[model samples]
Target: MNGFAATLASQLTSALPATAPLIKAALRADPGLLNNCVSLTRQLERLVYEPFQAIMKGDLLKETISKGPFDIVIDGLDECEDKQGVEEFIDHLLDFFQEHPRIPLRIFIASQVEQHICERLEDDRVQLCNLDSHSPYDDIKKFLQVSFCTAAKRDRVIRAYIQEHGEWPMKPDMDMLTEQTGGSFLLASTIFKYTIQPATAEDPTTPMDRLPFALRMNGR
Candidate 1:
């Protein structure tokens, strides 16, 4: 991020524009730095990666970079079309940070678990956690509770029903519906959807008509 792009060689070219000035300034200050470099790759290394790393080091020393030791979030890696490119990115990224341990940058990747990705990331440096292992029962229950309370504020039919019946869904009904959701957020969401929907003249199924039925329909 100092100046080099996220990818190694592929991103090196785009970083040239930003790093060019810094490279020029350094070269002017000391002309003999890359004067002996015969290889194009070495010349490019001088122009981009070296300058970028130097800038990073300078910034780190000065504490000028905001979000020091910042997190780099890579969401939806599994959805990426270029599988090999993703692999290379993970490899180079981990190596770069590992090589520069003092550099304050934390990378966090969130993706649908893929075997190849899992295999590459299974290292002592990487703490691989299974996010889906935890039960979502409490979360789902809380979601339903909050959703029902919010829906009660909006729906006239539900409001009227609550006023007449004390609560649209009694404690037993709430428990039944929450239990029926079975820790599935999708099912919990649909239960709330059906519980708040307005009655149409054609269907004539008001939220009040749907709330009690959701427990029965969704099943315990």
Candidate 2:
């Protein structure tokens, strides 16, 4: 199995203890499948698909699904370095769903739009939603507020500034910063770190000085 698949399998096995015995059973049936030289397809079949089938046969899949929905969340598919492995994984995943139409498993994948991923997931079974359509301003603002509050307790510079100036990055300043970030968590995180980073010998700037500079740099 590839790194991504290996990680996914590990997480699934850890999360679902019942899979352990099924995996052990498969490995006992064919010890060679555990070898590193084994093909990804064979490894997946033995380790993942077979165990899932076992669970289904044991009626655990039905019992679990009867309670409610079961979702497997995979975050940042585009970030994985192995593009071919990702494609292969997606192919196998779609094939699994197609083969087992009765399986009530929902795979929630969060990824940036890439041609390979887009092409593979453009199937009728997949429901794609653009996350950018959702407003992230409130979430960003909360993150920034919590971050600054925590920093104020830790950073001596910020503490000193707060003592002298009532409150650093007052509500209006925070509102402006949140607006400037334009609902992008990445931008909000970058600006937060840039503004509150500790003073360095090469770039000696306190959070007090940098906060306003950050606001100006991002066109307040």
Candidate 3:
């Protein structure tokens, strides 16, 4: 998450060199932007904090407003290299919100449970959800069906298989694979990728046989 923030800051600073001073001033002034720097700062802030805030505030209506709230969606925080920067970034963010209690900014972060990030984000305003707890089987099945259907439309053999079989490994097959996946979207996607690999003369398309292999690969 910190890495993302740094990248964002670096990009914004590179694009608008005057943004840093402006943002600092804006933080001092009101909950919104004042100058061009403030404007850029708000833009940076929006990039990191707006989407979740919009959802939380239920402000889905897209209307032109003089000033808007900040929301952010951050994923893969644990993968970020600079731990100290991430901590400082989060601290400043929390401090900003602490100073301005009514600022309509929210942040949604998705990451594997890492101690430093989790500990900092354990504040009352933060809402934590473990991705492992979410059932991704249905999501994976739908995704696979869509991808396969799209691919089959382009590939003659896949299309012929679907036509001859009356259904291309239909819903039940998808469900079984989903169950086998144990709710890991990554695992399911890897399985799908392996299953769809082009068959050679020696190895005909036996996706069922390949499923076990995919699962084993995932276990590693």
Candidate 4:
């Protein structure tokens, strides 16, 4: 992702002057520099403006409404290769929103807060969510249950185990697994997959016992 961002930034630095007018014509609703060339304009348009427009307008069925009022979500902003470009993008975006106070479009971005990006977006209208503050245990547990249930139905071993064990993952096991995960969805998922795999089997009477050991082994 970082490499892609860098490559994109390099391309933008070379092509921005020629492409700025085209971009402005394409995003007429967006309020920013129509003449000023910038490296991140294209990336910002695709990741930010386009998604914002889509969300505000709802689906692509343009026949229903001429315009839409909606919010957009952008994740992994820091992954972009161009640091200065990212800053400029945020600056123009904030400026646009400031100019058009009621465009019915909101943007949500998730990333490791960088200084330039943070400075540009720190406004009264913007809402910041700290992912570290959330309790992800319940969410991870729910995701694991749903994912495993789907996988179990297809895999003969898992399906047979569930039948023999009277449901492989009961409420109690879920609680334990959730606690062990410490609210990391990736950790929980990796552990769950390993536990259910045939190679990890130990001929145990219950699948519940394997969960704790598997999670521990995976450093969950």
Top of the candidates by lDDT: 2
- How far off is residue 41 in model 2, in Å? 4.0
For residues 51-146, could you state the per-residue lDDT of candidate 2 as single tens digits? Answer: 766666446766777875457799999988877777887888888888987775678999999998999999998899998898888999999999
Output the lDDT of residue 171, model 4: 79
After superposition, which runs of candidate 2 have C-alpha atoms over 4 Å from their true positions? 13-29, 34-39, 49-71, 75-87, 98-105, 111-116, 132-139, 149-169, 182-184, 199-209
TM-score of each: 0.55, 0.62, 0.58, 0.62
Candidate 1 whole-model C-alpha lDDT, 0 to 1 = 0.67
lDDT per residue for candidate 4 within 32-121, as digits (tens), equals 323334345554555344443443333432522455444345679877777776777677777777776766656678999788678877
Worst 10 residues of 4 by lDDT: 1-10
Per-residue lDDT of candidate 3, residues 37-69 (tens digit) = 343334446543442233333233232123454
CA lDDT of each candidate? 0.67, 0.80, 0.62, 0.62
- In model 3, the runs with Cα more than 4 Å from the true position are 1-6, 9-72, 96-106, 201-220
Winner by TM-score between candidate 3 and candidate 1:
3
lDDT of 2 at 196: 88
After aligning candidate 4 to the native by TM-score, how far in Å is the CA of 191 from where it should be?
0.8
**What order do you get sorting by TM-score, best first?**
2, 4, 3, 1
* TM-score head-to-head 1 vs 4, winner: 4
